[model samples]
Target: MDITSPSFKENATRAIGDKSLQKALGNVERGFIYKRAKAVAAVPAFETLRDAARDIKNHTLAHLDLYLEAYADKVAATGGHVHFAETAADARDIVLDICRRVEAKTVTKGKSMITEEIALNDHLEKNGITTVETDLGEYIIQLRGEHPSHIIAPAVHLNKEQIEADFRRVHDKLPPERNLDEPVALLGEARAVLRERFLAADVGITGANFLVAETGTSIIVTNEGNGDLTQILPRVHIVVASIEKVVPTLEDASAILRVLARSATGQEMSVYTTLSTGAKRSGDPDGPDEYHVVLLDNGRSAMLGTPFEDMLRCIRCGACMNHCPVYQVVGGHAYGWVYPGPMGSVLTPTLIGVDKAGHLPNASTFCGRCESVCPMRIPLPKMMRHWRENAFARHLTPPSERSGLGVWKFLARRPALYALATGIAVRAMALLKPKGGRFRTLPFASGWTRHRDLPAPEGRTFQAMWKDRKAGK
Candidate 1:
């Protein structure tokens, strides 16, 4: 996907005006927030699990080199191939080489964000290999020639009516009068259409929720069973994952899994928690003939010791985005990259230079809901602040914003002048208050007033109010 984080303000402005998108975004709050809260409330130890998950990831990342080495050794021992990719292009080439070697005509994919990050589908299609998304949400967006709006819920930006239209448009062979008015009807049609593709696909690619170093197992947690078929039915299974996914043991993966589902979908466990170790064994009834894991770094190595290191702990559960006020309004596409929401705000700037993605970190309202709900307890707001600081230090921020901040800094350093300035401004605004006690338009603040009215300041400033209260007035 192109780096449109640079145009986030424009994208968000457009998103705010999109009635369909606004309707679709309502699902985030209605579907995710309450369910997650109820699920966490049921599990009294949920907070403890979050702490454990954070610690597990921290320890693994601290010793990531050793764990990755151990993971590769185990994969090789189990007859699976491990390809280390330092860049997105390298990862794409590795997968392409594997497909070419196997003479793969068709490839089936489970929901893999890393592949999206690398633009793998476009690359494969351009190279003459047909790639099909087995995940229902992925398939819908793929049909529309768009990327995922939300990580866990790829087509969350769409409604069943829109999906029905896309299905009618794409699956032209299906009966024209078939009822796709409901989500179940859409599911049945997708299942029927994808079943044949599953059998015909020569290669299957999936993203790992966790890569167990102890057993060389790649684990995927999904509500639907698409991931199982994607990795099992094909002749070759390829796991594309970032290096941070590796954990020291199955026990560690289990500890993290406890919080993953609850935080992600509010389920105690996903319907399908599939783990693939390697190729088919001597007496195996059904499994892939070959297994490959394309471990991608893609700038993650550079984040190991930085403030952004905590972002690598993300399990892609997407709890942060679900509760983020800004994300709930603008949706994910406005952020313009594979990942979205608070996680994207921090990670995008790090992965794609801060110069290009400087606007993302500033997108947050700093509500701290993201950090509170994060399964890994990642300090999303803090990391975003770091990005803002980095952007300012590098002079990547706009000159107007810099000048505004510089002026604020000058006033802030002088307490008396700051107090006098605020008092005068507050009284002036009070005198100029409109009939409704809100400013529909303000000089030098069109950006703030463009979409909504800003409330007029009260007649008294903080200093005046504080002094009056202290004197018992």
Candidate 2:
């Protein structure tokens, strides 16, 4: 809930030293990536679906105002209240107002990044309301008093052993001798604990994966059915989501849904894909008595028709983060914000201001993996480059980095000088090599050399080798 983004460098360094965190991060690659590849392979038209999804989002974002108006009308028509929040503070207040109206003592919630972005739980608790997380991964992090490290898998930074310990420590009423060695046992304990909270809570809250204009419906895709219970079992249901989540029609939403699960968790479909239009109707057997939707802009409106407009197409499936090498090493917590990874790198600066979150865009290796994996085909690396240039233009970049780039730019403009400078630098590096042809320490390169040796320049530069090959007469 705290904005530690300014201390991202320190957070990353600390995360590197945590063995448990490293071990937990390993599962991300070995599990999600591999499964997603297999899932994509099985679907022959997966690529086509991706392009279709991207187009749908592009079209929707271009006419976002129209769709949002239509969505609001549909919600009103269904007897649901639609609240527009221009900022995070506005969103928090709207939720707080609803809670106060109901005299809510406790609120049960499904996983929602929008809620995290607004710091909803902290604000509610500060106002004397108790918020209980119903999702298993969310419940674990809630018990540990930590923010989500991963978007979909909130507790991905934790392992089974850590979870066992958290449960034992938090669920004080449980028998001390109970076996929580297995994942099933751990899940069962959390389920039992959350079930009681769900039954007793006065209000329910959730995040929407998609909002349909034609139906005024909020959609949630989850492996666990906790979201359903979070919404249906309570007296009042509230949906907290960003403005970008709205889609024009049910057909467009269906197209996006086709790729959402495969891109996020490598499944054909999530176990639970629930859609709700509004509160219980006259004929409805069982449902909530009240329905409300909080739509937060939080700086998204300023991005339209700008260079960052493409970022508005994000579906929040989290494929970009899942495939990012930078995210893989440091983990999401290092980004030090509600959103982390490639999408976060671009979006956080937009929402929270570039000065505070500039390090996020700079953290990428720009390998293009995020773009390739994204179902929406968002140019994540290009957007990050835009941020880098913005930072440089504003003089927000450190003096050393700015000077280095300035020198490089000066040399790059001259072809002959650039080649000569690189040739001489390569020869000098070769001469400085000791014994194993590696440099353990180098001035201005301690950041890299501290962790791994820099391989010595073997001979001439690649340009020289290419020139020799081309001139082989």
Candidate 3:
């Protein structure tokens, strides 16, 4: 889609005011948070698994070049083509070229964020190749002409009612009197429609959750069986993935997979964890005849030796986003990019530049919930802080925010002055407090008081309270 990260503030304002969106956002907390907590609680070694996952990713990243070479060699040995794409444009061109060589008229796709990152669908459509999204959520959003709001749950921002409306509008060929009030009905309708597309497709495209270097396997984990059909029922199967997605071995991938589903959808294991090595074997009953992998760098290799390199460890499990308060409130659309939440805050800035996506890093409250729950233990808040510093250094941050930080920095350097100023300001605010011990508006903090009242400071600074406690007074 378009880079809307620049308009994040405007998008967040509109999202907060949208009642329908607020209602849909409620599902995020209710559906994901509790389920993840329960799933994690059930696994006694979950924390240990998280550490293993992080170490696996770190090791793979360190030897990424070697692993990638090994992976390409393995794919070649199995009669598969491996194309390395240095840019998003290159990735798209490679896929298009493959499709043209195959004389592909229609393509079916599994849910793939890399495809979204490269804007593959738009490019293919523009080239007269009809592309269809086979995943249910993807199909719904495709009909609505929208990008995924959440990484794993694309239609999480939408409700069943809205989906019913879209289904009715787009599937006008279906019976007008047909029932689609239930989610099952919606699934059945989508399945029926996508089944046709699957059979008719000349090529099927998928995103890899992990690419195994040892076996040259491209693996995808999905709750629905759509991924299997999308990859198997077509003449050509194309895998599009970022370079960082490659793991050194299948064992490393399995270890990482241990935490992926729990952190993502709270399942012990996803219903379908399919591994494709290459094209169909001689005795294979059903498989693609042609297999290809397009490995897109897209600025990832640039992050390798940088502070943001830790972000590459992301499994796309989305635990960070699920627990991010900012994302929970505003939803993914507010971030205005292909990715959203804490991971997006750091990654978006690197891929698109802090100049365009500066607001995303500043969007966090720095509560650190994202880091706490991340399967790979990515320090999301720290990465966001890095982006913030990058933005400020590049003069991309707004002047008002820069001045505010400048004022804070001056006071921060002098402890006594900072304490005295905070003490005086706290007492003054306490004296000015209304009957309910809250301020409906503040002189320089109108943004804070706009949506909710600010509580009075209780006539003392945190330092004073701590001093008193230390003295046992």
Candidate 4:
């Protein structure tokens, strides 16, 4: 919740040293990558679905203002209240005021990154309302008094033993002898604990996966059904979501849904895809007495026409982050924000300002995996380069990096100079007599050599070879 993006290098350094976090992050590769690969491979039309999803979101964004008004009108017509917040402060105030109006003592929440972005839990708790995160992953981090490390899998940075300890520490009264040795036992216990909170909650809050303008519906997709309970069990239901979540129609939403789960968790569809249009009508079986939709802009509106606008098309499926090599090592927490990974590298700078989040974009290797795997097909590497250019132009980049780039730029612009310099450098590298023909340490490449040896240069420069071939020498 705190803006620690400025200290990302330090945070990443710390994360790298944490053995437990290293073990936990192994799941990112072992579980998510393999499952997503298999799932995508099985669907011959998955790429077509991604293209369709991207187009739907693009059309929606192009006419976003119109769609937003239509969505609001539909929500109001369905007896749901819509509140637009231009800033994070406005969103937090709007939610707190809603809690106060409901006379709420306790609020149960589904997993909503928008709420995290707005720091809603801290605001509600400070205002005398007890906010409980009913999502299993969120609940674990809440109990640990920490923010979610990953967006889709909030507690993925944690291991089973760590979770077992948290449960033991928090559920002390639930019998110390209870077996939590397996994932099922742990889940059953959390379900039981959260069920009581859900029943007692005065207000239920959730994030929307998609808001359908045609139907005036807010949709949530979940594997555990906690989102269903969080939004329906209380007298008041509050939907806190970013404005970009709006889709033109149920059909459009369905298209996006086709890719969301496959991209996110490798499932064809999540277990629960609940859609709510409004408040309870007369003779309705059971539903919330009040339904409020809080649409938070939070700098997203400013991004509409910029190079970064493509980022708005993001589904938050986390496929970008899941495939990112940088994120694979540092994990989400190192990004030092609610959002993390390649998507976070782009969006965090837009939301929080590039000056503070400059390090995130620089963290990438530009392998292009993030863009290749993204369901939205956002040009992540290009956007990251855009951020770097902005940082350099603003003189916000570190002087050392800027100077290094300046030297490289000068050399790169002149073909003859570049050829000459590269040839000399290649020969010099060979002279280093790199043990086993690899450098254990290098002057300006300590960062890389520290982790692994730098192989010595091989063969003559291509320029010399080209000249020889041309002359038939």
> TM-score for all predictions?
0.97, 0.96, 0.96, 0.97
Residue 159 C-alpha lDDT in model 1: 81
Scored against the true structure, residue 284 in model 4 reaches a CA lDDT of 86
User: What TM-score should be assigned to candidate 2?
Assistant: 0.96
Choose 1 or 2, whichever is better by lDDT. 1
Candidate 4 lDDT by residue in tens digits, 15-79: 88999999999989867888888899999998999999999999999999999999999999999
Q: After superposition, how far is residue 418 of candidate 2 from its true place, in Å?
A: 2.6
Model 3: lDDT to the true structure = 0.94
Query: Candidate 3 residues 192-243, lDDT tens each?
Result: 9888999999999999999999999999999888889999999999999999
- Model 4 alpha-carbon drift over 4 Å, by segment: 466-473
Candidate 1 global lDDT: 0.94
Q: List the residue pairs that clash in candidate 3.
A: none
lDDT of 2 by residue, 150-184 (tens): 89999999999999999999999989999999999
Quote the positional error of residue 15 for candidate 4 in Å: 1.7
Off by over 4 Å in 2: none
- Worst 10-residue lDDT window for candidate 3 reads 389-398
